[model samples]
Each structure stands twice: as structure tokens, then as C-alpha cells.
Target: VVKYGKWLVAAGAVGMNVLAARDHNRAEDVFGALEARCSDDPRLCDLGDGGAYLDPGTEALYQQSVGYDRRARRWLIGGETALLGAAAMFVWELTRKTHRPDNIPFEPEVRSLRNATGVGLRLSF
Candidate 1:
């Protein structure tokens, strides 16, 4: 059970990390698209004291990119947490003591009755 739990946590960590990477990539793509759009239109690149002036559509796209970035950060945090859990489980398993019994030695006996001789092996569990 402990072994399985460790593996499960490790798998979850990997999954979360993968999701984070995918979201990060998506965020990059969206930001790149936004940049391309801004470069094509000078009006979209106008910067004021507050921030760059963005149209409604461009603003929505920027917000989408921000959302992706936020999601990526969340997944990364989750992945790190799962990875730590897995590491802790591994350490716990390593430090745990097993309840296995000690090895038992086998004894062989030879008996002779009448004109017959037989050998018998004995084992204790």
C-alpha cells in the first residue's frame, strides 16, 4: 500500500507539471499573438501613464493571456506540492521497519525401521 501510494503521488506530480507546462506554452502563444497584433497596429501600442491603450478586443486577448499565466502558476504550485508529498512518502517508507519473520533453518532426519530407511525434512514457519 505504501509503495502504491508513493507511485500515485509521483504520477499526480508529473501530471500537474505537464499541465503547468502546457498552460505556460499557451500563455506564451497568446502573448505572442497579442504582440503581433500590437505591432501591426500602432494605435494598439500607444502607451500612457496608466498603461498601453488597448481596444476592447485587444484587452480581452490580453486578459486571456493573463488568465493562462495565472493558471500555469497554480498548476506549478500544485505540482510542487505533490512532488513534496511524494518525496515525504518515499522518506517515510525508507525509514519504516518491516515485520517480516527471521529465516528458519531446515532440519533433515534419517530413520530406519525394520529394513527400510527414509529421510525426512522439517521446516518451521
Candidate 2:
């Protein structure tokens, strides 16, 4: 169970990294497009008129992707944390020592010698 939890956490981290990288690339693509359209001076684009420098569709996609990335990151962190906690608990449970009831009966042995009999109790760890 602990091993599985570790794998789960690792997978989530990898997924989050991939998502972040993809979102960054998408955002960069939009910026590049805007820069090209504005002759490398995106700041000079019609800003006061509330004009969208980038294509409306692409901008919406970038915005949605960023929002999804943030949500995914938060969820991944939560999932990883939960999985690690569960792994710790599993390891602790497996390694912890517990007291058991002493239920073994003691056996006595009697041996007869040439002229005497001896009695002894047998015990084991």
C-alpha cells in the first residue's frame, strides 16, 4: 500500500509538471503572437480602447488553460499530501510492535536416574 501511495504521489507530481510546462508554452505562444502583431512593442498595442491584442479565441484558451493549471496544481498537491500521509500511516502500522497474549503452557519433564528422579520445567523464547 505504501509503495502504491508513493507511485501515486510521484505520478501526480509529474502530471502537474507537465501541465505547468504546457500552460507556459501556450502562454508564450500567445505573447509571441502579440509581439509580432505589435512590431515587438506589445505595450503600444491599443490598450485604452479595451482592444484584445491577441486573438479572442486564443486568449480565451490561454486564460482557461491557466485557470485549469492552477486548479490542477492545487488538486495535485492535495492528492500528493494525502497519499504521503496514508503511506506514512501504513508504514507505521506495519512496523509498530504490539503485545501478544502469553498462551503457551509450561511442560514439566520427569527423568529417572539410577537412584533418583528429577523434575524440570521446560521453557522457550
The candidate that wins on lDDT is: 1
Query: Roughly what TM-score does model 1 have, to 2 decimal places?
Result: 0.75
**Stretches of candidate 1 exceeding 4 Å from the true structure:** 47-52, 101-125
> lDDT for each of the candidates?
0.88, 0.62
In model 2, pairs of residues that clash are none
lDDT of 2: 0.62
* Model 2: residues with Cα > 4 Å off, grouped in runs: 40-44, 49-125
For model 2, how does the per-residue alpha-carbon lDDT over 12-91 read when each residue is reduced to its tens digit? 65666566566556656665665565675545454435554345544554466556566656655665665576667667
Model 2: weakest 10-residue lDDT segment is 46-55
| Candidate 1 deviation (Cα RMSD) | 9.0
Candidate 2 residue 35 C-alpha distance from true site, Å: 0.5
